[model samples]
Target: MRSLKILLLSSAFNGLTQRAWLDLRQAGHDPSVVLFTDEITVCRQVEASGADLVICPFLKDRVPEQLWNHPQRPVVIIHPGIVGDRGASALDWAITRQVNRWGVTALQAVEEMDAGPIWSTCEFYMPADVRKSELYNGPVSDAAIVCIRDVVEKFATGFVPVPLDYTQPGVIGRLQPNMTQADRTFSWFDCAAFIKRSIDAADGQPGVLASLLGGQYYLYDAHLDSRQGTPGETLAVQDDAVLVAAGDHSLWIGSLKRKAQAGQETFKLPARHVLAEQLAGVPVLDSSIAQQRFNALAYQPIRYRETDHVGELTFEFYNGAMSTEQCQRLVAALRWAKARDTQVLLIKGGRGSFSNGVHLNVIQAAKVPGLEAWANIQAIDDVCQELLTARQLVISGLTGSAGAGGVMLALAADIVLAREGIVLNPHYKTMGLYGSEYWTYSLPRAAGSEVAHKLTEECLPISAVQAMEYAMVQDIGPRCPHTFDLWLSQQAQSALTNPQYRDARARKAMLDIQQIERCREHELAQMQLDMVQNRQQFAEKCRNFVFKRKTCQTPQRLIAPWALTYEAGMPESRMLNG
Candidate 1:
């Protein structure tokens, strides 16, 4: 295919857009991507881009006719559902309905949204009990790639798309209205899975509402609970969560937001922590304090299981943020797992995200943000240190996206395996922190010095397929999690059967130890110095980013620095907006 300039536009720079950008660029297309910042001026910028095709993947708003009907340009919007499924809540509705199959559709941007002529479509079976974000990022992304590549390839050949036909027997989808809180609402009569599906549908934002604790609150981050209790009662309180009763079973809610009154500002917080005042009489059953007493409420954030001599440690944290306490607990778990008789260690991260490094939310909420940030990184360092110096054969199995310090943590393992469609953001400069977790050591070792420099400095997300080349990902597993887990287990069992397994394990462990020894001291020193003597206001930057208060334009380093200049008498810092 001839190289065509493609401008990738989306609602925001999310996991899906990041994945599409990398895939399109790698396919030899000259792709320029931008977020829809709700700016009218951006339309002029789109025209100025001189792109042959404009691809809008997961757009909240319809593409303007001016841009779509350009003389030589083609505008395609990637819809998250089937051909005729027109709405903003495609994935949310699918998860809520528990449909067996879901898909991505690409169509021309016409007057009617999602009623445009169809370009391409790809279907995927919906996974069991997965969150909306996970479904969107994983299966939806992979299918979108197929749908995207097809449209681009056909467009290059001047192939015209077929218009929508309501009478067509093959067309199955119809309009689905935007799912509201009322639509997702359920009572105590509903089973655990039904309630969970509702929560997962609204996982990322605008959680499902339920009247509880003598008031109304929207719930998020729910887990299946085994223990039974009186229907609609708060049975127990665990670390930052509450086990609330359902009809058939119970659910452990990790996070929620109290419905705001007339003028109150509401924020999503850890469930139990926010409701501490309301649950005054309820027993607090944190893992550290009363693990045995509240064994039913005791949720292990990290757990280890062995089968066929393979020790699999699964760490499924919410949004992949590793708080200081979470990291310390994970370290203890890792140490205990390492002593097990298993020959291979498989580190499985979360369903939504593999990891995104230290908990920015926790750090930002601290009394002293800088000191808290320092302590959290140090805590994670212990977890990574165990990975670096481990004697067992370690392989990081990433079923979901990973970023920043998490990327480096994956690299610390002897081998990294990821599902086909996962994305990776492996840079720290975005947060303005000289990151710990032996990144300076792991990154270069995995991708070499030059690629390492470009990756960190560019601060771009890479697709798993592209990541295989640059990030040195050892293997790309099955696209489906069910098949992926089966295949992964088989591989671990196969490794046990290898007569040379002992020799291989020893060889890899020795090499990693030698590499760590060479740079650990120097890297630690630089990180400490950068943190303690933060002349660049690193903590302030982190705080702003966490709070979504970043207002500065793109730094000069990314674009032409000469185009921006300070006023002669004003400060150089005033040069941010030319």
Candidate 2:
């Protein structure tokens, strides 16, 4: 197919949009992203892009008439629904109703929203139990890709889209309302399956509203329990999960989204922490005794799975933030896995996060912010050091995004592999942190001195493809995050069995020894000096960022550098966030 000029418009450059943009670019098409910043700016930006087509992967807003009805282009919207499915809550309805089948539709952008002409459609089977976000990001994302490619390929052949007709036969989908709290209201009188369905529908957002112990909280991250108990009664505490009554059955509450009360900021925290006072009187089951009970599906912070002499360790921290406690736990996990008899080990992070460096939220919440920041950095350094010195072949696999120290820590592995479209922010200047994850040793060694300096000073976000070019990563996996795990396993397993890899291990060990001897201790000592002397400023910045809930905006220097003086009124323009 010939290369076409494509314009992508979305509320944010989220996972779906990133994947579609990268895929289209690799297929020899030019694609540019547009954030709905303002009406006038966006209109001027789109017209300047000279786009032959427009694709909205996960856009919530409708396109304007001037651009949607371009005289020389086509506008397409990739809807997360099946053919004839017209609504915003298609996935939510499927989960709550426990539908066995689901799908995605690619439709032309006409005035009447999803009622527009269908370009392509793809369907997939669904399991009986799954979360709303998990189903959307996994199977739903896969189907959307298939439909998008089909539509794009057909359009390249000069094919016009067919209009939607309700009279047509073999249509199963119908319009549905947006899933709201009213749709998810259930009490102890409901059956176990009913409770689970309600929770699934609101698992990712606007969780089911309920009250316990005279306080109202939104419950999320639910796991079904096989044990039965009386309705509305407290059961037991399993790790961070809280077991609560669900009619005759039970379910584990992994986290709670508390409402703002008494002029306090509303935030989500672990169930155990949020309900500490009330749960103190609840029965606490012994580990061995709890083992005898029916299967309990509580949250697993760290999990290890082995296949063909390769062990994969996955650490799914919430929002990719690694608190000081979380860092220490991951260190212990890495040490235990290293002592095992496996020939190769894979460090797999979460779907939405690998590690975004240290947890700013936890740091700001600490009693002494400076002391907590100091301890957190050291804990992560120990984790990186362990992976750097492991005897087995260590592979750091980033299934999600990584930033700051998180990006440097992943470099500890002998081979760093990332899923396609994964964003990496290797700089820490935004948080007023010089950073201390042994970056001084790992970064320059990986990408050379020139690129390392530029990366830190520029504060630019690099894509997976650019990381490969800069020698910062070994390989890039599937464009779709859903297919990354399978592709990574195939590559790593094959790499382990190669005879040449066995001989290369000796060289790797020697280099590791040399790095420790020359750079590790020296860099860490300097970090201590920098952080200790700048304690007050560091503390204030972190507190401001966390309490104010600020996001990292693209640095103006990156777009209009002071080094270059442009003509007046001709400002340098760029994307919303680099």
Task: Give the number of the best model, judged by lDDT.
Answer: 1
Q: Stretches of candidate 2 above 4 Å error?
A: 189-193, 261-265, 281-298, 305-312, 341-343, 350-353, 360-375, 397-405, 417-436, 443-507, 512-578
Given candidate 2, what's the lDDT at residue 83? 82
lDDT of each: 0.77, 0.73
Per-residue alpha-carbon lDDT of candidate 1 for residues 338-374, written as tens digits (9 for 90 to 100)? 8878878888875668899988777766677667777
Model 2 residue 342 distance off true place after TM-score fit, in angstroms: 4.7
| Backbone clash numbers for all candidates listed | 0, 0
Query: What digit string (tens of lDDT, one per residue) describes model 2 on residues 315-403?
Result: 77766777776788788878878887998888988655688888776666567766777788888888888888888898889888788
Report lDDT (Cα) of residue 395, candidate 1. Answer: 82
Winning model by TM-score: 1
List TM-scores for all candidates, in order.
0.87, 0.79
Task: Please give the distance, in angstroms, between residue 474's alpha carbon in candidate 2 and its true position after superposition.
Answer: 4.8
**TM-score, predicted candidate 2 vs. hidden true structure:** 0.79
Q: What lDDT, from 0 to 1, does candidate 2 have? A: 0.73
